[model samples]
Target chain A: MTPDIIYSGAGMVVFAMGLYGVIASAHILRKLVAINIMGIGVFMLLIATAHHDTLIDPVPHAMVLTGIVVAVAGTALCLWLAVVIRGLEHDAASHPSQ
Target chain B: MSPMLFVDGLLASGAIALALLSLNAREVFTSIVLFVCLGLLATLIWARLGAWDVAIAEAAIGAGLTGALLLAARHRLREPTSRDDTPAARRPHVS
Candidate 1:
């Protein structure tokens, strides 16, 4: 098999695994991790497919760069939400008599 | 398949396995660590596929920053003995 074909196949498999994890996992953090994994797989596939062009497409690379940044920002927000939820729980636990 | 293809396959499989393990592991800490490893593996794969920028981003943002956030959140949420009790039950009823 060609290198691109192999990479594409592998990317698909990883994507499937990530999808399965997202569907089956109960914890919110695990779901977030699975979503990130799937994002990586999609990024890999886009980069690999762009290699087919003679000059290599810059468009997909640019898009993926934007996606990476957005992904990080989204993760940060999710983490903040998790922290907030935990804090609420902590407050509720500590002031039970109040 | 070429040697490059073989290597890509191996790295890709490793990445998938790590992701699965991370999501499926019972312990949250172990899952977070494994998720970081998966991000590293994905970085290597991106490098192999000639996406150096993506590789750097994945290593730095996906793995490093995310891992730190997860660790911090885990610490904030740690309540070993309170695992059995629901958060709602721990709250005071403000009558």
Candidate 2:
């Protein structure tokens, strides 16, 4: 059993668990966290694939770096949207005529 | 098994366990904190998997920045409003 396969298998399990969280959780923030976890799982799998017995591949590493940045950006955007919507809901609920 | 292999397995399981715990945590704060720990574990796993660059990125962006963002958002989300936001209070609208 190679280390690469072990890591990738774990990654897949993580991804599945994240998927479950996203579906099962009702809270918007928790959904965002689950999505981030899913992204991390994918990055882990990519990292495993990049490693070799002789030479490590640079491409997957680069991909993971960029993916990390993008994932953070996406999460930030989602959080912003959620907060905004919450504010709107509060406002509407407080003043029904508005 | 070689020590290194066992270590890698340990790290992988740790990461997975953290993810699961964070997702299922009863409190939002607890879950967010656990997510940060997961990110740290993932950063170490990146290094163990021989991706030094990705490790740094995960530590800084994944763990550090993401944790900060989540904490801030959680704080904003928990702000008190004029009306109670609980499901029981809002049930009249659903019916």
Candidate 3:
């Protein structure tokens, strides 16, 4: 079998696993990890699709680069929100008598 | 299949396994660590697929920065309270 086929199949499996995790997990952090896994699968699929003429497609490469940056930004924001929620929980816990 | 194809298949499988492990982990910190490993494996897959630029970006942003953010957030969430314990106290329409 071709490398492309093998790689794409693996990527699909990863994507499916991530999907299941995201659907099953209730924790925000776990969901974030699952989402990032799915992102990696999509990136791998894009790279695999770009393999042509024994070379890679620059367009998808560029797009994946953009996606990496955007993913990081989004992750940071989500993490920040998680922190805020945790802080709120902490404050509420500490001042339960108030 | 070529040797390069074999290598690519290995890297892809490794990436998939790591990703699945990251999601399957019940401990939040362990999941974050696995996510970082998954990102690094993905970078290797990107390089194998001949997307050097993407590989670098995945290593830097997806793995490095994202891991940092997750770690920091995990630290901030140091309270031992269970998430389900205080749903009634939350704001009604913050979504």
Candidate 4:
């Protein structure tokens, strides 16, 4: 019963849940969240594996930090796009003639 | 059995539970809140794993910034008549 084993198993479950959400949800925002969850799961698994008895590896830590930054940027862009899309939808609804 | 392993187990389970609830919540707002919680729990997991760097990054960029961005977007979307309703084509260039 090591912490690594527990976190890795949990990561797999969370990743599966995220995959299911991405497949089942129609809303883009939900899909975005699902993607973030999936990313986190991958990060968890990576960090879980990087643990060593003697010394901790720095590469995975660096990678995860970069990943967090990239994820935030991607999420912000996705949210902007979603807002733009909703605005377009509202326009279409309001102006049925156009 | 070390007490630290016990804490790690709890955090792992808690994170998974939050992820499930976050994805399946009835409202997007609730889902967003749950997602933020998931991120925080994830931070704790990183700390337990001895990745202090990752823990701070997850807390600030992952949970804080992402949640704030999502909530702001949700606020904009919730407005019935958004100021952003002006169509792109209708707006004149600001040359």
By DockQ, the best candidate is 4
Q: Would you list the C-alpha lDDT of every candidate in the order shown?
A: 0.76, 0.88, 0.78, 0.87
Output the better candidate (2/3) by DockQ: 2
Q: What's candidate 4's i-RMS value?
A: 1.1
Error of 3 at A81 (Å): 1.1
- The residue-by-residue lDDT of candidate 1 on A1-98, one tens digit each, is 26567667767877888899889888777777888878877887887787763566768878888888898789778877976777677778878985
Cα-lDDT of candidate 4: 0.87
| Candidates arranged by DockQ, highest first | 4, 2, 3, 1
Superposition error at A8 for model 3 (Å): 1.7
lDDT of model number 1: 0.76
The residue-by-residue lDDT of candidate 2 on B1-95, one tens digit each, is 59988898899889889998999899988888999999999988998888999999899999999988988888777766525667654442211
Question: Which parts of model 2 have CA positions greater than 4 angstroms off?
Answer: B82-95
If you assessed candidate 1 against the hidden native complex, which CAPRI class would it receive?
A: acceptable
Worst 10 residues of 2 chain B by lDDT: B86-95
What would you estimate as the lDDT of candidate 2?
A: 0.88
Measured by C-alpha RMSD in angstroms, how accurate is candidate 3? 7.0
lDDT of 4 by residue, A6-93 (tens): 9899999999999999999987778989999999999999899888767788899999999999989989998898878888888899
lDDT tens per residue, model 2, A1-98: 47899899999999999999999999988999999999988988999999999999999998889999999999999999987888889999888998
lDDT: which is higher, 1 or 3? 3
What is the TM-score of model 2 when looking only at chain B?
A: 0.81
